[model samples]
Target chain A: MIRNLQVAPDHYLLELRLPAEFPCPEPGQFMMVRLRGRDEPFLSRPFSVHNFRMHRGSVSLEILYRVVGKGTLLFSRQSKGTILGILGPLGRPFRISSICPTVVLLSGGIGVAPLAYLAHRCRGRNAGGKRTSIIVYAGARNAQSIVGIKHFEAVDLRICTDDGSRGFHGPVTALFERDLCSYDPEKTMIYACGPPAMIGSLARILEATSFSCQVSMEERMACGVGACLGCVTAVKDNGGRIRYERVCREGPVFDIRDLAGLKTDPC
Target chain B: MNASGTFGFGEEFAPFVDLNELGALVVKGLSWEPRQGNPPPRIIETVGGMLNAIGLENPGARAFIEEKLPFLRQYDVAVIANIFGETLDEYPRVAEALSRAGGIKAIEVNISCPNVKKGGIAFGADPDIAAEVTRQVKTATDMPVIVKLTPNVADITDVARSVEAAGADAVSLINTLTGMAIDVESRTPQIQNVTGGLSGPAIRPVALRMVWQTVKRVSIPVIGVGGIMRAEDALEFLIAGAKAVQIGTANFVNPQITLEVIAGIEGYLIRHRMDDIRDLIGSLIEPDSLEHPHEP
Candidate 1:
């Protein structure tokens, strides 16, 4: 552990010095963390890599989390130099389809962690050398819950809080929906990560559109690897049959249309 | 040894674990047909353990042989195939299929999966049915048979002894305890299946007591399972007469746990000045037999 800083109420930004030989994690990939030698919380908790940097020839990882349960509470109390058990870079990364002209990054509360990393990747030009415009819509329950905005270098950054203490009033999804009129479906791509309700709202808004999108999901997991067969999310197979896929392996990021909840035909 | 379901066909942990270091790799319960298993919210973490209702989802016997078994064959570990059925007759068929595959060293009959409706715990809960399943599998294959017993029964020893009598070469006890947890705020069950099999450190003491009981009742070799996280935990089972120990939930926490446990057991032997592991097996000293209580 390098730094453990409380960025907001009930939220923290933990920095860890990754092993020199550790592989670089893609933006949407995650790490499973547990306090070294602690047994109260038996299983490790999965956290998306908020941001990472090359520090003194080694990788430095940042994890943004909220104190929602026993595991996060324990993580909040730890100080510098406390060794931890970390299982890395697991799950498939977000695939940027084709040479898109614009990328929309959406998030709610601590969900903005991974999107910040995505935004960092979006800052540069695409394979065709066409400059890609980046836009981020981040939201939270209140202003105190809004964080990680400074880490993003997006061309446009919109913030929304439930209590109206931040940029826009009401939900971030509402702000994104209001701004959706100007985006060209052929040139734009959307990526989201947030609370289930927020994601659900965004999914409903994009259900009938041709806009390409991917959303990251969260679940309580025993093993961050696929072996446990735990942490599964409902999704439609190629045959349109609803089947469970491991969130840890198959994806933490999936196309909006593939999720079973958004399937048009009810089985 | 890794308990079934906790270790997937052995390929998933290859990056972090050396499969050859394990005593045996027990694959997840394979049925006659590919099963999708349970729905969402299949697993939930409790105080010290987890409740899972994965419902024995696997790529049937044939698929396992064609796809997963080949990957496992690359590793130099003994592969124990754990098979189950929804009906009584399916047991022999699954066992016969795996036996024909040639790589599997033993067949561990899983008549104790609590998540399923019909053939799992139903057969294990009754001694006669457990014995019948064992007898049928033994008749169908030339491989050694090990029947896994459930702790969700009135008496695990009765099931153990019955299976032993039915020609089981070995017995592994005890499978997870049937358990459930509720989300008080949501006013609903934490697991989608309502009740799941609980495995972890919380069930260690109960599992230890049951393994000790079953060891005394059965003449065959007994393998202790359930919530064995550390070498000390495995040693407890060994001292209680378990010939082998299987680590389940701990594998989820650390993939290299089995290697650490193997090293820890060796360290214990060296510290105690014991030349052989058999010296520790069934070494439990009763209170009345304690000659040097303060010598340690």
Candidate 2:
């Protein structure tokens, strides 16, 4: 059972009880949730474990939805006692360099989930007072999808909106490009997760730059675990050739250089 | 086996099954070492069947022996460790590791993995390589080695005879046939691994034909596999000259299928007064047996 369901209007903060036998999920790992009482969609949908408290047998998932489909609308209305069929924390996680003193977390809307975990992990580590600062450039269509702003008050946060309804009147990538010019590329590593447009735009922005980058992605996945390679990406292999990789297994997190195109697995 | 990715080990299916009733528990294919496997979209579903390109993911021989073996110990089923590898050397090493584990009753060497791009041509493709690899693994372990032939080959009989000559104790057929599916709107392949191994009801006819071909070519016992969804399907394998039968894609649909199939086979046997199952082995319309009805 997830201990907390921190509702922030548009998004539901779901906490899941991680079974003891479950492999400890890393920073970028995601889980598949089987929505009950819904028959239209036949399979489970994958979600990243936004934050984990493995010692306490719980994982916090940030679900940012607009209550559209039966799956989402049904999930949003469910009571706390709901017992869902779920399997995870599937897929590979992001790798944070212990030596990096500064890092940039790029996200748009709910893409913040996995990055939030990365930031928390950096903060979780009992480093000898190592100064690690995470700068987030998060965006959404408007304020609703970006509702979890209050949670990161202590961390540096920058918000963006598409229609000038919020912080910057553009996608998160635009602001990221402007700020990244001054940020030390040698010392700062970028971690991003968001829609394909944002991720693709950021990839274009950072193509010539020296900063190492990884992006957490989303696709219409049935089995959130690697068993179903429904969420695969085209990664450029060693010989400059592209091959499919399951996001649920190889990564929700992957080096930007390895990605051939900013595309998700077909639904 | 678990048809590559459809099933893991026998654990998930146990709740709905009395595993001991299974003639042989063929676990999923394992490699010499651990594999990260191909990236997501490894599996896809179709009407009445499914396809997968799990890339034969397993926890290498070491972890399989160390961590997973314990759960399978109490079961009375014949545990066949299906092994696969990239090269010839890896096959023996995997067989030796599984043999050393002790509980695994036999080793089923899967030679037809098409996902890999290098090294050996799929084991069932070339009779010489198939025979060579079979020789290496059979010599490496004391456990009976069952060479699992693939349907993708043109002449499965050549490889079947080759492996039998190479000292394989028995053989199993038809591993999943290679196939694919696509997503129309975006015009992209549905599986992350663009192509996947096709299994389930769709491949039953193809699988049966290949098993029959191998059955006639080899002297050893044949274990039939592929799209076996019902008791009748298992009966079909027995009637087609298989010594034993394995449930692959059917386990993904109904976990209790192994027991369900056994019950169905026993019920069929009772109706026919076929008291001993061993007598049914290779009893498929024996051309000479029909002329002299009661003669073996």
Candidate 3:
């Protein structure tokens, strides 16, 4: 059941309260959602987990989405009691380890959804005496395009807008490059999720840096499971040979270095 | 039965549905070597249908036997290995390797995948090439060989008859129809591959017509597959002369659809006071004559 719906400038946040038995999703994991009794928007739409809360006997999950096409436009108008058919906590998730004491999250537009969840997880890990530091760099077209900004309040936040109407007056990558000197390169690990062009630019910049990075990808999907094999991303294996990995199964998250070539020319 | 490439080796959906309840489980398309498949944007949702250009991505036959076969063996349902190839010789080699592994119940030759660049739709489009493929696979393995035919052909019955003449035990029809979708706003094709195979409720009428035509021409059992989402859909195929039907695209929408279809068929038989389900096969009524239409 939908608990709350909040509208941002170009996007919306939907909060759903599910049964307690619903499995807890890790950061970067997603759900395939569809409106019940409708077949026009036939296939389910994939959404990253923006936030989730566990109550005594129930769980509430939040999804942050932009109104890009007909499906999302319809989702924006759904009422409180609207029933949605969902399938997930699907795909591989971001990995947080103590080895990397400084965590940096880079996002573009609605790509902030999964990273917000990761920042929340990093906070829990920090409370256990891990001494982890969380930093988020978020970018959008303009101030109005920025959504899900509140989710990162617990972490140090830096915002960028293309038109210079927000915090930093440039691409997020530019801000990240200027701030790269502050964090210890060896201790920092960057996690990014964003548009293909932004990811492409970041992949190029990371090649000269010592910090390691992981990226979450998006594609048109049919089956959330591996059956359809619809969502695939090209990646170079250890031998430097390119192979197609199903974004729905093998990953939505992969090491940035593994996707070296395809990041620039990804379809 | 679950069609190839629709059910991902039966393990992914085990949590939602019982595997043992299926008539058979046909895993994804396996090949002589591990295929990387096509690039991203491989799927798009159309009106009452969906398109895909997955390109038959799978671990090679050897890796499949080592990793997947063991998990499938635990279930009581028969396991059919759907094998594909890049060349004519690769077909027999893949069949021979699967035969040596010793767990597969049958070999369903996937000669109809349109997503690949070569040897899939190529062999199925020609009657002689389809016959040679069936004959080679039959010689390489003692397991029952079922040749899957594509609907893109000029005459699907000619391809079906050729495979049957080459000693195929049964045949499955109609693989996805070739189609494409475009994003007008971006002015680009929806699928990166430019074209893909269309599947879902939109193609059901075409599949039913193809199955009805092919069954009359071939002597072997026809396993109907194409956009079966309900028990009534399966009944339509059975009544049109298909001995059995495989659930494909519907598995993605609802994993339990196959089980529900099975129970629904049973319920149908009980409601009609019929003792056997086979009584529904080829039950289409005609006023002209009761004789099989395609017989010489």
Candidate 4:
């Protein structure tokens, strides 16, 4: 581990030195992390790559997290020299296409980590030199909860707070809805990751407008690899039949239309 | 052995550890038809363990034979297919399907899964029911059948002896103990199924005790499984008369645990100047049997 920085109240940005040979993780892909040699917390927790960068023969990635539970609480207390176990670059990554020249990254609170990486990657590739326009809509409980927006260097950043203590005085969904008419739905793609409630609200809005969107889901996972089927999400096949697909395998990122029943209570 | 349910088809751990190093790769519990399993939150972590109500979800027997079995055929590890059923009739059919698949070295009958509503622990909790399921599965396949027994019973040995009487080649025990956790704020159960099977280091002591008792009762080989996270844990079971040990929840903690455990056991044998693992198996020296019990 290289650095563990407290970026905000109860939130942190953990930087770890990666082997140069490590496979670079795509924005939406995640890694399972746990305290090395500790058996009390039997399973590793999954975290999306907050930021991935290389500089002067060194490669490191930053993971953004909040101390919400025992696993994250213990992770927050680790020092710079603590060695942690990690299983990486697992699950399907967000697929960016040329058809959608305009990409909208929608995130809620700490869910902004992967979206920040998505924006950074798109700007780096210049969307394969197609002049892609990038926009980010970050929502949180208050100003203190919003995080990881600084890495979104060259994109349009919009912030909203539920408590009306930040940029826009409402949920991020409402702000995005008001500006929905400005972009052409045919050329725009929306990517979202957040609390289930926020995603539910966005799903409702997108259903009415019929814009193409994909959602990154979070589930309590035992094995980040596909071995344990502990992290499955409800989804509809092409036949519209509902089945559980491993979020750690087929997704953490899935097209909104493929979700079964659009139920807010993720199983 | 990578315990059933914790290890997928063994393909997931291929990148981290060589499959040839494992004693056997026990795939997830397979049903005649694909089961969606219980609703979530199906899993929750406790102090030193976790409760899971996965309810035996899988791609079904046909899917395993057609899609999953091919990937496992490349490996040199012994493949043990763990089969279960919602009904007694489903048992033989699924066992026959896997047996016909050709690559399977053995079949592990799962009558002990605690999460399901019927045909899992229900069959396992009763000696007669467990024996019936074991007999049916055994008759359907020419391969060796090892019956997995549940811990959520008055006496685990009753079920073990029953299965042995009915022609089980070996027996693996104990499956997760029935447990539940509640969220104080919501006043709701942490598991969607109200109760789940508890596994990990928390259940190791109880599991080891059961294995010792069952080992004494059944003449057939006894395979110990339940929260075996390290080499010492595996050795403890072997000393208690278990022929072999299976790694369960520890695979979730570390994918390379099987290799580590295999190496650790070898290292201990070398240090003790033992030539064979059979000398270590069931080699426990009771205090009363020793001349000076207190002397180390």
User: In terms of DockQ, which candidate is strongest?
Assistant: 4
**Candidate 1 clashing pairs, residues 3+ apart or interchain:** none
Under the 3 Å rule for N, CA and C atoms, how many clashes does model 2 have?
Answer: 10
Between prediction 1 and prediction 2, the one with superior TM-score is: 1
Candidate 2, A206: how far from true, in Å? 14
lDDT of 2 by residue, A39-117 (tens): 3343566677676655555444444444434456556766666777666666778887766667788887778777777
Q: lDDT, candidate 4, residue B108?
A: 96
- Per-model lDDT: 0.89, 0.72, 0.88, 0.89
lDDT of 2 by residue, B40-76 (tens): 6666665445566667667788888788788888888
lDDT of 1 by residue, B114-166 (tens): 99988999999999999999999999999999999999888899999899999
- List native contact recovery per candidate, as a fraction of 1: 0.75, 0.21, 0.76, 0.62
The TM-scores, one per candidate, come to: 0.95, 0.60, 0.94, 0.96
Looking at model 3, the pairs that clash are: none
- Where does model 2 sit among the CAPRI classes? incorrect
Q: A192, model 4: CA deviation in Å?
A: 0.7
Write down the worst ten-residue block by lDDT for model 4 chain B: B287-296
How does candidate 3 fare on TM-score?
0.94
Where in model 4 is the C-alpha error above 4 Å? A127-129, A261-267, B289-296
TM-score of chain B of each: 0.97, 0.91, 0.97, 0.97
Could you tell me how far off, in angstroms, the CA of residue A30 lies in candidate 3 after the best superposition? 1.0
Pick by TM-score: 1 or 3, better one: 1
